[model samples]
Target: MPLLKVLRPTLPILVGASIMLTLGMGLRQSLGIFLQPLTRDIGISVSDFTLAVAVQNLAWGFLQPMAGALTVRYGFRPVMMIGSVFNVIGLALMAMAHGLTSIIIGGGILIGIALACTASAIAMSVSARAVPATVRSTVLGMVSAAGSLGSLLAAPIGQVLSEDYGWRAGLAGFVVLSILMIPAAWYAGRVDRVPLPKTSGDEIGNTSAGVAVKAAFSNASFLVMTCAYMVCGMQLVFLTTHLPSYLAICGMDPMLSAQTLGVIGGFNVLGSLFFGWAGGRWNKLMLLGMIYVSRSLILAWYFMLPPTPASTLLFGALMGFLWLGVGPLVAGAVAEMFGLRWQAMIQGLAFMSHQLGSFLGAYGGGLIYDALGSYTMAWRIGVALGLAFGIIQIAFALIRPLSPPPVLKAA
Candidate 1:
């Protein structure tokens, strides 16, 4: 008897998608470690660093919808290749940066654009298409968790690289990694962008890119998700960018700060997996609301409690639980309402809102600290935003879906 071959179509897509997430998220998150060294060399205040990061985030936000459009006109492989190119250029420029302005151009603008083009939303959209509809949330969660693995390890690895070599060498190291992505992206080209069966529905939508944008803008649900994501961006970027510095300010050792960040990253993987499980078993909207509420409550409690190593670690753990886990839920929501065919474009547009919030969170926290002589005001503001997110998501959940708008058959 001849050996039988078993078909396993989803496996390649999963592997390709996961690799993209790990590299994209891991490298972007590690940029935070360069903040101090870059500032000292440039002779700029921390605020300058903050502003540059903020602008970088803003660039990511502004470019997202456009990239999504490109993904529509082009295909996943092409867009991802463009992203990899930008990543290499941005990191090289940043590594060789001299002045404050140059760093902004390198670290803020280029890197931000690169991340928007190739990161979580783009990769997970592809992963979403590769799986069964019922497994959508789980697949998205796995993707987020994969990225978190990068986030989890980035701090320690970045620290070690910076120590063994130097900050410049560390930056150079990632630039090399970005080069590797070029090949990975090219290989990803082998996977079909447009689904097989070449049936009418395989295409993402018949609605033109402009029409889809207009429809998404018109949808109240989309608006609510966008607004809620702003808070998500703010909270996430602020914590990730400044948490190490903040720990230092609190009189903790740098090693301890690195450890805290690592733990936060580790916890995020668990958080994403657990929430994804809940997303499949429960009402996704409600789960989203609860995540926000939990964040708000945790921030409030952290503020009320005295600062201690034990307290900080506990807070970091809780924050980790709510971290990128939101990615899968939010991305899943986009796929749920819209179609996965245009998943990258739609999610990119949504993420633009997120990066805008990130701009605010990252730079705003620095401004708050510099102005107030402490981070008190910033922490308080985070609590307020958390509450706001909860409210927005809850209100969105109450609104009825618009009769599942005509599923424009993709040709």
Candidate 2:
């Protein structure tokens, strides 16, 4: 199909969304590098910095549904522009963070909200609309891979900046990068919305954005997808934030830490793309089940692996391959069952669950470490949760998608 005169080609929209996501997540992940440094600078405990990051993660989860709703209502242009502004403000405040309040509100909450707006929910929706279903997964993976690209850069760069410059200066680098997203988002909004495919599931119909969100929350399949995603967030945020520090304290080299992290990012591109393809070719619920089960195994091995470069590389590669595939898988599933007309909002609500998980991951990991004086316990908890989540997801795949809720006429 030809690009709409007013809308850009789907390719550009995907590219734009990818750029925004990469920077947003890349910069956020880099905060782990600064976790100890920033806390020490402000004379606060790790708990304080963790709390701020936790708030940010939770806020992103809570706000995603709202951002998705707005995207459905007004188009992605204005909403993405708003997200860009939030990024600049949040990064600026984070760079100047001198107290807990500054860190929590500016660094944490604002950034989370921005991520909800521009991350997978925004990017995948655009990709789903633009490409044929046959290749949509590949395109979606490509977009997500861009985020890993950012993660690849953020670590070493963040370490260098924080070590040679200061945490504030390092954060300022993200601030400058974030400012460039404004126009890119505007272009993304111009893509024409694609019609949803016909399937055995309920017939997706046109509805006001408000009605769509209301109905999505009430729908059973959407709920299952959302709930499953919540755990994904928790696992991710907790691991990313605390892993390096734990490794370092265990007598590991700093270079190994960075390399392991970078390797994860590199392998994740493969995971994201493979999962995207799997979503289209097979059942989404089953794919999720497999991913989670594999995660449980990976966590088990990761805990057993001694602190060393070889083990670190192997673990990083394994986990990275499993990361971020959830976004495309879940988002594509929602779009598949409910249709695409209200996708932005419905997908956003589901992503909120992810944000909540992220909150737990960051804050809970920090809390566990502080309380135990070791990450051994934290790693054990992760293994249990992964197994439990895998079982729950396997059960979820057995049911058929429920019908969309009865549409109400306007009063």
TM-score of 1: 0.90
> Which residue window of length 10 is worst by lDDT in model 2?
402-411
For all candidates in order, the CA lDDT equals 0.74, 0.75
lDDT of 1 by residue, 256-344 (tens): 65566777778888988887777767666767878888888987887676667888888879988888788888777777767765667
- In candidate 1, how many Å is residue 145 off? 0.9
Residue-wise C-alpha lDDT for candidate 2, range 274-387, written one tens digit per residue:
887777688787788788888878888878867677877888899999987776787677766666666777787787777777777788888888998877877777778777
lDDT of 1 at 45: 77
lDDT of 1 at 376: 81
Candidate 1 C-alpha error for residue 149, in Å: 0.5
Q: What is the lDDT of residue 325 in candidate 2?
A: 79
